[model samples]
Target: MSQVSEKAVSFEPEEKKEKKEWKINVFAMLLVLLVIAAVITHILPAGKYEQIEKNGYTTVDPNSFKWIASTPLGFFDTVKSIPTGMVEAANIIFFILIIGGFFGVLKASGTVEALVSTMAKKLANREKLMIPIIMLFFALGGSLMGMAEEALVYVPLFIPLALAVGFDTITGTAMVLVGASVGFTTAIMNPFTVGLAQGIAGLPMYSGMGFRLVLFVVIYVIAVTFVYRHAMKVKRDPASGIYGKFDTNEQDSLLTAKVELTKRHKWILTAFLINYIILVFGVIKYEWYIKEIAALFIILTIIIAILGKISLDDTVESFTQGSASLIGGALIIGVSRAILVVLNQGHIIDPLLYQVSEEMKHVSPFLSVVGMYNFQVAIHFILASGSGHAMLTMPIMAPLADLLDITRQTAVLSFSFADGIGNIIFPTGGTLMAGLAIAGISWTRWARWILPLILIEYSIGLIAVIIAHLIGYGPS
Candidate 1:
């Protein structure tokens, strides 16, 4: 849909008063759904009930509950199941805090601003090249940064530019979210997601880069085309639904302004350059953590804040608030963990895998496991958060691949496909949520436009993995 429509909703001053009420209602509904889904999923495992009878009914062992493992939960069983997810919840909370801290530093130091500005200059000048430029940026960033949060800050920066270029906010958000997601599955050297996936799957670090690069390009081409088509559609017909509720940021004007670079902005830019140089050398010379890399950003932010005369109080508050901005995204990761803990504790995960393999075994080898890519899809969906799904699926899928005679590398590639494309569909994903929030888009609106393209690309990517597997292009 186009960005110029009268039908499109605007979040300007008048809408603000009404939106607060609607947002609360929507949030309340989502919380209810999360609780209901968790409770039902936690109690649905029946296998633990069979074990309960075998172990004697009065056993008080906390682990005996097996929430999803037991088919039906008696009232007593549900009461006892609450503690099972505590650890998972804690783990997610801890990780988010650590990363959020880095975001605070980077944003305060103006490193993020500098980076976004550099990208904006390229994008604003080369409006027609937005799709490919975004695609390349996603791949390059994913390969180096190791996680997808790199896109979170940038998504906000790009949404305004997308609107200026004649696309609606939702379409803009879709391009960033879906484009980055595609990059994730096809990452060449990402340590957090791909590196972790290979580690669990027992492959060497960075072993599949050559093939993954191919995957990156293939997915990138498709995602870019999808985004460009939507952009063109918006340009052609401004009344389309895709442009609803498009909002522009005040900072966007600074990007388009032709003022001579100020001393403070220049120092901020210089700090960013030196910090990146140090970061690159660190990554190449020492396998330092990406979070640690972001530390340099924090240092630079402080220096720039002081030099820019932004005031100590404002700098402190910005750091505090910028870090706080990540809390909601972090919370989604935690909520997603609740889903995983229930699934894992139930012991249904392995049995679920066995069921999938058995079904595939009955069919021809050529079309079976690869065709049933949805099994990987399902496993990933259960652990629906991005990096979290990789951790959950890799250890399980790797061993299963061995038993089924599927190459481990090919299975890893399938896991990538399974994890990446589905995030486009699953609204629970944090990156997707952040993208929507930044662009003022809704889950309902995004799905209508992106799903068809995602499905087509998913089918093609799955076939590509199968072809790569058959051609003997992956690790043995």
Candidate 2:
């Protein structure tokens, strides 16, 4: 009877078994986008813009756009762009890997756990305060300096912190992503976006500071409120969280246990703070970029490993494990860059920009400015780099603003609003995708959760542009 039952089970149809739910892979999605971008190249007319070097900035001549021979990517070329994109984005990829390795060393050293545990205990009663405090800090970083990709390093730290505090990963992720985004969008003194755009538009650097400051306060309030409400809701009802259960089974003991910051942990924390101080100083004073920042982190990683009293082999192992955790995010960055590669190789970016700019010319000044704002948002998907987008579009938009009787300052504002806001939600944005990957959140899930915020910010952007036009926002 047992042999007969076994034979029956072995012959059971596979279709009778429960099927696993299919989840979309980010890499597969990027591959599909690569194919779609190639198809777009075939459909759209190719064109080129004559770029001129002015004040060490290469900007396109608005009137110099002309149709060019099409150069759409073939199948092999589409596949080849992946490695090319990886090569193009090598600095960013390596930066992310180094950050992972750094954090890995930090976490392995018990510094992160000790810090999170201390914070959790200290703020157990006032845990809600964390959202505003952390968000505001990151927002200031973004507004003061273009702090986008740099914010990713905080994701792993924030995730566990949020989890420890009875909040979800989304809440933690928002503290960095949305906070920095709000500040970046406002662009009070953000050199990468506002500074570059204004220089190209012939406005003094950060000229419209007063108005941007107003926007910053207003948007920061909205962002904090949004994140705070969500955090509280999750706290009150764990099931209300987006990620369902906050699974910390592995660390449940650590989270619930009393953790004190020891002398070594304090030293590690001080080292981190000093490193950040130097990083900011270098960025502002010397304009340090990827290569410099990566090297700094490598040094910090070594110092951290030594301070933690971790053996060399263990330190190396921790670094490797940490870097390995972020490999998915690093690849996402490469794939995101590939989309731009395909579009740039096809020479359609200029044509698309020309078409949109020409379309705006036929509208009223108010509507025209609004169109320009929307155009910046649309173009951001392909041209994700703030400085690159500014250089490519500002020269054209600045003159177009003049032709349409709008101020160049408003054009710059529109560009900043679009570029900054789009960074958090856009799948094509390498930083956003990389951050999402690190947080273990799918792009679709993030989009749904962030949709309302995006809508509110978009509305704010529209109003800001309209007000800029009505009141003549200019470099005074």
Tell me the lDDT of model 2 at 7: 19
Query: Against the true structure, whose TM-score is highest?
Result: 2
By summed lDDT, which 10 consecutive residues of candidate 2 come out lowest?
A: 5-14
Candidate 1 TM-score, C-alpha based:
0.73
Residue pairs with backbone overlap in model 1: 45-68, 45-69, 45-70, 45-71, 46-70, 46-71, 69-346, 109-301
lDDT of 1 by residue, 1-476 (tens): 11221112222211231223223332444445445544664544433312222111221121232334254333444334434443555443443443444444444444444444455576665767876777666657665555354455455445555665556566556656776677676767766667666766668877868878877887777777877887777667765535444433323443553434456667766765686667657665676553564565567666767766677787777666654654555455555544445444545554565456557666665665575566777666566654566654555566656666677777777777776777677655655654554455555556766778878877876787778668755553
lDDT of 2 by residue, 263-355 (tens): 999999899889989989999999988899889999999999889999999999888877887788888888889999999999988998899
| Residue 402 lDDT, candidate 2, scale 0-100 | 96
Per-model root-mean-square deviation over C-alphas: 7.6, 7.3
